[model samples]
Target chain A: MQQPIAILDSGVGGLTVAKEVMRQLPREKIIYFGDTARTPYGPRPAQEVIRFTQEIVDYLLKFSPKMIVIACNTATAFALETIRSRVSIPVIGVVHPGARAAINRTQSGYIGVIGTEGTVNSGAYEQALKQLSPHVDVVSVACPRFVPLVERGNFRSEETYNTVNESLAGLRSTRIDTLILGCTHYPFLAETISDVMGGQIALISSAEETARDISTILHDKGKLARGDLLPVHQFCCSGDPQMFKMIAQQWLNEQIELTPIVWQVPHIG
Target chain B: MQQPIAILDSGVGGLTVAKEVMRQLPREKIIYFGDTARTPYGPRPAQEVIRFTQEIVDYLLKFSPKMIVIACNTATAFALETIRSRVSIPVIGVVHPGARAAINRTQSGYIGVIGTEGTVNSGAYEQALKQLSPHVDVVSVACPRFVPLVERGNFRSEETYNTVNESLAGLRSTRIDTLILGCTHYPFLAETISDVMGGQIALISSAEETARDISTILHDKGKLARGDLLPVHQFCCSGDPQMFKMIAQQWLNEQIELTPIVWQVPHIG
Candidate 1:
């Protein structure tokens, strides 16, 4: 009944985080924004990713939400620090949670990270993991093919498997005990990945961990919702609302109406 | 790592489905048996609860276990037909998994269940809600004092202000969204639980659901352990190292070394 928790991502990938949030915290309302039109932010420049994230945050703040969850790994990698400095409210990102989970799970101290080129190239997961445990051995692989496969909803297909298998072939030799699915979209491919990685390796989902972080932050801040008002959820996308709507309904398992939002240009000085 | 999926329960409470099958089959070697010391086979006479559950299962099938995860709840309730007739390998229980998770998260269901004198008497928290939900538009109160005021492990303490004020007092008046956290364990007092429950209502834990049903029943029963050996686990218990260790260590986290089991003779038999 108070302000909803605002979440934003480059696209539907963030829905994974949203789904977990909904399951773990069913009482809270959510206002989600997906810049689907310009998704695969993994390929974008850091400056551009930060600008887009800032714009979305600006729009989302209008709701006076209790917190903001940067559900996109790339956005978190590029803009989390910037956004935290800009906003007075709490802001959470996926990378740190994912890294922390991976750190906790990996008994071997050897960890593998898979994400888009930008995320892997940015060395976000590697940095975060090392910061937590300086001795952890981090190996990152850029799977530029994954975001496209997920965005197109091509999981479980032979081709998707082939792509994943090929992309992750090198890591097989790494002997890492944990693999961090650095992107939110990766959970949908968990079965395939788990098969490829074997049972011994724990695959940490950034989305799941990020949701856990959100829950902790909310509780610690005393910002958790109390009453029993049925929460109203708003889903907006900068891309095709039809696709977003279909995915939303399927993901949330509830019939949902989606609205399209256009980024407003800031006035030049 | 060979054959082991042994499960048991006492009078119920399956330990959140063996802690989500040790956090999603961390290499498939589980030997679980919940002695609960006396065992809770439900309404049936002790003889029946044991004969149908105990004798048939053979004292937690202490041997090389391939797959056995009864995890309590409905297994003891409705699905006894399937497990009894299905396989010869092993069997499982139902209470742990059931108690671990809320049956259904409702926005307005505000379900209140009365567990009766035995359950409420057991301080199980079930009886308290049923009676309450039926009334206050669906909210229950249990003065059972069974559920510990975990902060101090004192349910009667006046100093447990936040919980007493936020949860009991609020649920007394407002319509609750969902009531998870059914078990009285202090671990349920985690930040995620508090943030998610947001100080109202009652609910259960589904460690399996939390761990995604043990990776979808071990990847659809291909019996999921793959390469990367190093899969060795020993299950031991606190009371009797033989009969209780698997379920105990899985329920409680620690480095456990299991000793061989030899079921004690039944006095009645």
Candidate 2:
């Protein structure tokens, strides 16, 4: 009777997927966990990110969510398969959404992706794009600092503007009609990324497509939570309560209570 | 000679403080944890948050760092006292640093505090401000939604912009020149908040102040870590790693090697 969908991310970024899911599916309650303690899985080695991603999936499984959405590009790249293999529930990631959006929006047949080193290095978006449209060429840049700048609340800072411009400078050499904000954090700099890249370049967030995927999956699998007028959202953070709450409100535009959960690493293999 | 400082937040929000600390203490290395799985400690009851914060503190203490900075408002409000009184090491919260900043910048003779419900309800910021300036008047708003918006990277959305405006609409009647971002996530909405309230209001972020506090505490207590320029960062999440990496790199602007750590909750009582 209680088939909550668990949406987990390193931080608030996952809310994008959660919000979309909320809009797309009114009956499903969501249990969201943002590993705010150790976020930014991008630059880390692949093994480490995979292991870290597993812990969240395992923890959220306690709620016995019917499905799990990675809601992050890095997780999709490194951990989706492992998560799917370890758990019985359906697992999803953001890479497919980004790819789908890129394929749908590109008029010039050229797309660009800007994300953290890990995401760019993993070639997740490129691979996804190739699968969707083999003829389309993708330009990828490792936006190493965009996430930090957005988290620091400096997306509009002159320095942030310059940093984003610097990171995106490569795309200027080629025309890209559709630009995927490959990383969730990149949406914060959407205005900046758009202003620099121009209005013509469509700034697509994978959130909408991710939400659509959840709907289709639920409909096809008969896993949608049944009978809940207002779905409940439970937020968990591993770090401090204050920062997590502040960010949640700013991101979700809803005032929901977040209960802190102690996550002790009793065993790390 | 591993003297890496320990920094923990629910997610990358604490990295703002960590970034400043790195600039201040270039020679020192740091160990950071963002409980990205479960974040936003504001709306929850005090006891739960305290327990959660304590677990991370206890976990990080295993490294035996000289000091620990709970660069989060909710943790400071709920458990900073207990942690400071009981822990062997010097424990600091971001609240005091921002409070000090508010005291210094408040020219209108009136101050406004905005943070998670826990922080405002706990009266931590108000009390901290009063401790510095007993006569000052402080208006506190428990902005529970700000964090989600920032985490979702919706700082520029119509909903987020509207929310910021709604939160600050009443604040203008108070004539407060200085506003403390009371929560780390509020800073992410700086543009919207600043635009809503106008730049005439100086937003005080505790990131730098908290760094200074940690530095002072470590210097005064002689608990600063010794040796090694390894400067490597270890991150852990209670959630998925893919989303974590995206936000981490964008918000923290640093490369980290994240490792898998199991999350266990033995007993809540």
Best by DockQ: 1
lDDT of 1: 0.61
- Stretches of model 2 off by over 4 angstroms after superposition: A263-269, B1-269
Per-prediction TM-score, please? Answer: 0.54, 0.49
Best by TM-score: 1
Residue by residue across A212-264, what tens digits does model 1's lDDT show? Answer: 66655564344666655557788888877777787777777998767534435
Cα deviation of A195 in candidate 2 (Å)? Answer: 1.6
Docking class of 2: incorrect
DockQ, prediction 1: 0.03
DockQ for every model comes to 0.03, 0.01
Lowest summed lDDT across 10 adjacent residues in model 1 chain A is found at A260-269
lDDT, candidate 2, at A196: 91
Model 2: per-residue Cα lDDT over A130-249, one tens digit each: 643445889988988876665555658889889978988889888788888888777767789888998888888877667656654553344555562566788887766677687677
TM-score of 1: 0.54
